[model samples]
Target: MEAAPAVLTFSPSSSSPAGPRPCRVLAGPAPRRARALAAPHPPRAVASSRAPLVVSSPPPPPAASGTPATTPAHAKVDRSGRFCSPRAARELALMISYAACLEGADVVRLFDRRISARREPGYVFDKACLLSYNHMSFGGGPLEVGTEEEAEKLTSQNEMDSANEAEVLSAPPKLVYNSFVLRLTRELLVAVASGWNKHVDILDKIIPQTWKDEPVARILELCILHIAMAEMTSKGTPHKVVINEAVDLAKRFCDGGAPRVINGCLRTFVKDHVDNTGTSQAAESKA
Candidate 1:
């Protein structure tokens, strides 16, 4: 067969083929090993598993008509773009008091400028009462709860001090306009500062962990509740209304869960201080 097939020989130094030209060897152990090594390793399979369970808060209450409430025309917008609802005279009062405490501005001057210009400003008598409360508790000066008649005395005394010469007191407190609301707010401020320890005691008993763990975070909530509980002590408004207003305020200024915490604290306060006899147990004790 065309001169017997040449037997193939292998040598490292040889460069040419030694077998017949037409014959070829394609399946060899060395080539198989090379192909196996060159091939990519397949990806390993991971076991399937379910995601971890998570506890979530309940959904928020539904809106009345799925529309956001509009701000009242009387609401005052401060330099910082903070709007206080016209009905939020109490909030405005506290804001001024806090400003007085932190900014070192005279309480009288701040009230004259900020609260005086409101659409339905609180009674000057109530303002004087607030000034007296601020002085005694924060200012550490004196406490003098003024009567309705003292409204005139307060006006005449501050007449020369104010630019609005027509009105004896620049911001004369309203007589019938939200009187209960103003009284509630003023009393709250007074009770909070004057009875600071008592409120703290109530908070300590109700939510001790909050006071101990996150005192700073809960400061606003505590202040709101302090005022709410103070308002409750007067017996002029129902407990539910006080709690609702406190929760609403917390929702506005505080982070999530604040409203719930406030509600809890206020409910506890009501349980302890309010009686079915339609009287404030706390007030009766004071009397």
Candidate 2:
């Protein structure tokens, strides 16, 4: 049989968030066998289409009752060979939001500048802006940053102090690079801000009851879930991919047993959403 066309692959280093991630430029097409190694974010293929058709989101469902939710068997796979993760985008967003709360900096402008500096893939940048803007809109303030926020503020002040006073005052900040990512990011920010509460309520329904009792205690966990909901509801990402991403984020960042909590809650959330929206056939077909 003729081989599938080869595509260049660049896998990001899972260890270093800031350091330059090594790129592996493979020459041959990937071997097609029983799938084992899988992509982290599987919706990249759908997102890659130049003129993508997004599934319009259904009206937000009412908050949960005691119904048991089922977990999906397998994660959906998007074979686009993307190296970007939503983690960087999320971290940048949180950082910008915290900076806004601490120093009153312009969050949008700061985020735009950071995007240029980071030089992330277009999809990753787009997802991060969408997730962060949605999270910011829902809370209407900076996420709880604790010592991290303080540390960031101190660093900024120190840099400003070290700069030549005349140079700092006279030199205008360089113009932001108007990349496709920036344009999409701005568009997402505005749209999410406009219907903030609507999206927030949708996510609130998806959160587990245990977490719901003391939402403040698990702020970051809830924040990640909110991002996943925004992706599933508005972006038309597969439910399995959304849940897997949420579970993976919890395992990476949240405390022990966090994966179970996130997975269970998201599974139930997906079940409820699918049932209400009558998208089981669509979801299953993807699986």
TM-score of each: 0.43, 0.37
What digit string (tens of lDDT, one per residue) describes model 2 on residues 245-279?
66765544455566687788777767765554424
- TM-score, prediction 1: 0.43
Clashes of 2: 0
Candidate 2, TM-score vs. the true structure?
Answer: 0.37
lDDT of 2: 0.38
| Residue 84, model 1, lDDT | 26
RMSD, one per candidate, in order? 36.2, 24.0
- The runs of at least 3 residues in candidate 2 whose Cα sits more than 4 Å from the true structure, single-residue gaps closed, are 1-110, 113-195, 274-287
